[model samples]
Target chain A: MPLIVKPTPAHPEPPAHKIMPAFATRFGPKLAGEVAATDRLVRVNALTALCDALSDPEQAHGCADAGVVETLNAHVSGGQDAPTRVLAAKALCGCARDARAARAMVDAATPAAIQGACLNDAEQDVRMHCYDALIRLGGGPRRGASSIVAAGYPKALVEKAEKESVGLQPRALDLLTSCLGNEQGLAEALDAGGIATCLSLLGSMEAAVRAAAGRCLAGLCFDMSAKDAAVEADAVDTLCALLEDPDLGARRAACAALVSVTTTDEGKRRMVPAEPRPRDAVAAIIALLAEPDAYLTTTACKLVANVAVHPKVRAQLREDKECLPAIDALIAGPGTDQDALVAQHARIAKDAVLWEP
Target chain B: MANSAYTHTTSPKPLLSKMKKTTYRAEDEENIITNNIMFDRRVVRGNTYAAQVVTHNTQREVERMRYESERTLRRDATCQRKERLAKPSTPPPAEGRAHIKAQTDTFLEELSDRPVESEAVTQTEAILDRPPSPLFIPSKTGVDKETDIPGGDLFDFDIEVKPILEVLVGKTLRVSMMEVMEEAELDAIQRRQMEFEQMRNAELVEVQRLDAEASRRFAEKQRRFTQETDRLRQQAELGQKVAARAFARSYLANLSELAFDQLEDSGHFVDPVEKEIQDSFIPWLFDSVVETTNNHISSSSCVDALIVDAIELASNLQSDVIKQIKQKERARVFAVEDAQEIKEAEGTAK
Candidate 1:
C-alpha cells in the first residue's frame, strides 16, 4: 500500500496577506523569475517588461526588490545578445534612479561593466543604452563617476561625442559631463579634443545637444589646463553666441560656461580683450544682464564681476552707458521682494568695476 | 727427538713489526714460543687420549638462551599476578558488612570501652496524621461510547463555513481596495511632486523675469535721474562759464565787496534787525492783525445773514404748509358737494 503522509502547511495560519500594489504583485516576481530563466526568449520578454515598467519611477524603485538588477547586470557583463543587453542596460538605467539599487550596482562594479560594454558593444544602440546607464550610474555612491573615469570612459565619451550622430552626441556629452567631475576626467576629456567638439556643437540646431555640449564644456572648465584649452579653442565666442539662443536651458548653460571660462585670470583677459574696439563677448554678457531670467542675470553678473576685475574691462564698462547703470540698479537692491542673489552678485560686479589697480 | 722438538722454517711468516714498541726492556728470545715451533708426536703430554668436548654455545647464543628463560619466568609471574588480581577476594564478606562493622563512625563514638548488652530494642515512627488520599481513579459511568457520525450530520459545511468565507472575501476585498488606494496615493504624490517641480521651475523663471524687469526699470530710473542731475549741474556750469558773466565778475570782483564795505562804514547798510522790524515786520504784523479782524467781522456778518435767511425760509415753509392745508379742506368740501349733487342727479334721472 502506498504510504499516506500528512502534509504540513508552511505556516499554522495563513500569512497576513501583504497588501501590495497590483502591479508590483503581478510584475515584480514574474520579471525576476523570467529574467533568471536560462531561456533567452523568457529573459528578453522579462527585460522588455522591466523596461516598460521602469518608465514609472515608482515601479523603478519597486523593481529593485525583484532581484532583477543582478540578472540584468549579468546580461550586461556576460556575452548576451545585443538587444538583450540593450534592454538590460535600459532597465539598469531606470534602476539606477533608486539609491539602494544604485549603490548595489556601484558596489557590484556595474558601472565599470557598463562602461566596458559601452566601449566594446558592437551595436550602436546597445552602446547607447550602456552609455545611458553609465551616465545615470555615474557620480553616485562609491565614487561612481571616478570609477567610470577610471574605466577610461571619458575619452571614449568625448570621441563618441565627436563622431556620433546628432541624436547620440548629446548622450555622449552627457556621459562626459557626468564623468568629468575630477581633474583626471577633465584631463582625459581635454586630451580627447572635447573643447573643439563642444565649441562646434554650440551652434547645433538641437537645443538639447547644444545644452549638453555647453554643460560638458562648463564641466571641463573646472580644471586649469582644460579651461585654458577651451579658451584657446575660441569657446568664448561660441558660448557668447549661445547666450542669445531661444532655448532657456541652452542659454543658461552657455551663461554658466562663460562664467566658468572667466574664472581664471587668463579667461578674464580673454573675455575682455585689449585690442578690439568692439568686444561682442562683454556686450553679450552685458546683454544677458537685462534678460528676464534672474538665474541667467545672476550668472551674467558673476561673469561681469570676473571680467570687470580687468582694469580695461572696468573702464570700458564705465564708458558703456547701459552696463554701469544696469549693474548699479542691480546693486541698488531689488525695488520689490525677490531673490537678492542677483543683487548681491551685481554689487560684487559694481565693486569690481569700480576697483582701482 | 725431545731435544729436536723445536722446528724452524727458513722463511718467516708475515707479522707485525714491533719497532715502535713502548718498552725498552729485553727478554729471553728462545723462551717465547712462535707458531713456527712444533711439538713432535713422540713427545706427547700425559692423557692426550682423554675426550675433548666441543662447546657449541657462543656468547650471543648463551645471552639469547638466558633472555628466553628470563622472558618465560617474567610471563609466568605476570600471569600469576593477573590471576591473583582477578580472583575477586572471596566476595568481600557479603557486601563488606564485616569491614563496615570494623570501621567506626566519627560522629558516633565507638564506646568499645563500655560493656555492651546483647538485647535488641525496637523503635517506631508514628503514622502520618492522614495518609495521602488514595490515588484518585475516576469510576466508569455509562458504557464506553463509540459513535460513527457522518461529518455532514455533525455540521452543515456550507452553513457553518459561510461566515468564514464571508470574512475571507471581505478581508481580500478590503486588502485589495487598500492596495489600490495606497497605489493611487503614491501616484498622486508622484504627480504632485512632478507638478511641484515644474511649478518651481516656472516660478523660478518668472521670478527671474520679474527681477530682471525690476532691475532694468530701476536702472533706467537711476540712469535718467543721474542724467537729470548731470544736466542740471551742466546747466549751472554753463551759466557760470558764460562770457558776459565772466567778464562782469572779473571787472567787479572786488568792487561789490568795497562798495558794500564803504556803504556799511557810512551806516548805509543800516541795522538790518531794526530795518526789518520797522519796514517789513511792523507792516506785515499790522496788516495781518487788521486783516484777521476784518475777516472775523465779515464771517460773523455772513453767519448772521445765513441765520436770517434760515428764519425767513422756515417762516415761508410754515405759511406754505398752512395754505396747502386750507386748500385741501376746501377741495374736500367741494368733492363732497359734487358727490351729493351727482347722487341727486342720478336719482332724478332714475
Candidate 2:
C-alpha cells in the first residue's frame, strides 16, 4: 500500500485591522503573559507590543489593570536585566496617567529599582525615561518629611547616591535634585544628607550636573530648615563658583538659584559669605555682564538688576566702581540694546543712582 | 657965468635966417627935451636900471609859470583821488575776466576727475528737452462710439396726462366717472384678493413644512442605517468587546499587524501577533484612543492636536457642506412645485 501524504489547507490571512488596543488591553493578560515569559526575545517582543498598545489611547485604557501593575512590580522585585526593567518602568509610567495606575505604581516596590536604573542605565534615554516616571509617581509617599529617617525609600536612595563614585554619582544626584522640586521630597533630601551631595555636584565637571545641583539647592533653600542646611553646606559659595562656569547655561542657572536664595531676608543673610564675601554672588553676576554671548550677558544683567534694586545691595554696588563700568560695557555691547533684559538692568542702574538719597 | 653975459653986447644976424633958425631950433629943442628925458632916464638907470626893469618882468613871468605849475599839480591830485574813489565802486572788466577764467579752470578740473563723454552728455541734454512718448496708442474715434441708448436718454419718452372733460350727462365723464364708483365696492374686492393670497400662502407653507418633515425623517433614517453598519462592522472586527474597547483592540491589533508584517517582510521579525490584526479598525480605534488619551496627556499637547484637527476639518468641510446645502435647497424647490400641482388638483375636485 502506497503511503498517502496529506495536503495542508491554505489558511486565508485575517483582514488587517489598524486599531490600537485600549489602555486596559495594553496592560491586560496578553501583555502580562509576554512580560512574565522567560524567553528573552519574547519578553522584548512583549515589551514592544505593550509599548505599541499603550501608544493608542483605547489600548492604553485596557492596559490600566492589575496585570500591568503586577508584572511591573514583579520586574522591579526580581528582574536584573536593565533594559527590560527600563521598558517595564516606562510602561508603568504610561499607565500612571490614570489615577488607578498611578496608585498601583506607587504601591509597587518598583521605585527603588527605577531609581537604581536611573543611576546605572547606560542609555541616557532610558535614564531620562526613568526620571520622568519617578516624577510622575508623585515622587513616592515620604516626599516632604523633615528627616531621612522619616523618608524610607528616598533616604536609602540618597544614601546610595552619597556612597557612589563621581562617575556614577551624577545620575543619582540628578534624581535626588529632581525630587527636591517636591515639598516633601525636598525636605527629605535636605535631611537625608542631600546638601553635601548637591554641593559636591555643584563642583562637578559636567555643567549640566552643576546646573542641576544649583537648581536643587534653590528648591531646598525655599524652606527654612533646608535653607539653613544649604547655608551650613556653603551652598552660596558653591553656587557663586558655578557663576564662573565656562558653560553660560550653568552660570545662568547658578545666578538664577542665587537670586531665588537671596530673595528672602533670611536667605539673603545666610547667603552672605564670610571672609570678604569670597563668592560675591552679585559681583559674580556683574562680572558675567561682560560675557560675549548676548543671552548670558542678558541673564547676568537681569540678575544684577534684581540685586541692584535692594537698598542695601544698591549701596554695596555703588561702593564698587568696577561694577558700574562692567554694567556700562554690557549696556553698550552689541545686541545689548535689543535685549529688554539688558535695558531693564540699565534702567535699574539708573534708578539706583538717580533714585537713591 | 650969467652976470658976465649980461654986461657984454654981440653982433646981430639976418632976420629970415634968425626966424628960420628959431623955428627949427624950437622944434629941435622940443624933440631934444623928450629924447633927453628918455635917454637921460635910460642913461641914469643905465644897464642896472634896465636890468632892474627886466628882472621885475622876469619875476612876473616866473610867478606866472609857478602858478600854472601849482594849478597842474592840483588837477593831477584831484584826478588821482577820483580814481581811488572809483576803484572799489565797481569790479573792473579784467577782474570779471579773471573770475571767468577761474570758473573755467574749476570746471576743467572736475571734468578731469570725472569726464562726461561727449556722446552721453549730448544724449542727456536731448532727453531733458523732450517728453517721453505715452505707452499706449489712442483708439480711432468711430471705433468706440456708444452702441446702445443710455438710461438717461430713455426718460425722454415719459409724459403726464390731464383730463379735459369735467362732467357727464348720462355717464360720468373722466374725473367724475371715477367718482361714480363707490369706495366700499373697491375695498371689498381688495379684501377678497388679499384673502385669496393668504390662503395660497398658507397652502404653500403647509407643503414646505411637510417636505421639511420628510427630509428630516429621511436624514434620520440614513444616519441610523450608517451607524448600524458601523456598529456591525466594529462587532465583527472586535469579536465580543464593547464598542469602545473593540475599537481600541482593533486599532492596536491593526497597527501591531502592520508593524509585524513589515518586520517579517523585511526579515526583521520581532513578533508574529503584530501581523494578525486588521486595518479598518486602525483609524477608529486610533481616533478613540487619541481622544481618551487627550485627558491623560498635558493640556498643551491636546490643544495642539485639537487646533490642527479643527483647521483641517474646517477647511475640508466648508465648501463641500455648502454645496450639499445648496443642492438640498434646489431639491426643496422642485418638491414645492410638485406639492403645488397636487394642491391645484385637490382644489378642482373640491
Please state the error at residue B29 of candidate 1 in Å.
99
Per-model clash counts, in order, read 1, 47
Q: Tens-digit lDDT track for model 1 on A1-357?
A: 212222332445422222123455566765677767677776777777777677566566666766777788788878788778888888887676567677667767676666666766767777778777777677455477877788787887777776677777788888888777666888888888888888888888899899888877877776657767888887877787788788987987888787777665677677665556343767777888788777677778777776776777778787888998888777676554444767877887787778774
Worst 10 residues of 2 chain B by lDDT: B158-167
What global local distance difference test value does model 2 have? 0.56
CAPRI class assigned to model 1: incorrect
Residue ranges of candidate 2 with Cα displaced over 4 Å: A1-29, A38-40, A80-83, A93-129, A136-153, A165-168, A264-283, A289-316, A319-357, B1-350
Model 1's i-RMS, to one decimal, reads: 36.6
The DockQ figures for the candidates are: 0.00, 0.00
Shift in Å, residue B220, candidate 1: 36
DockQ result, candidate 2 = 0.00
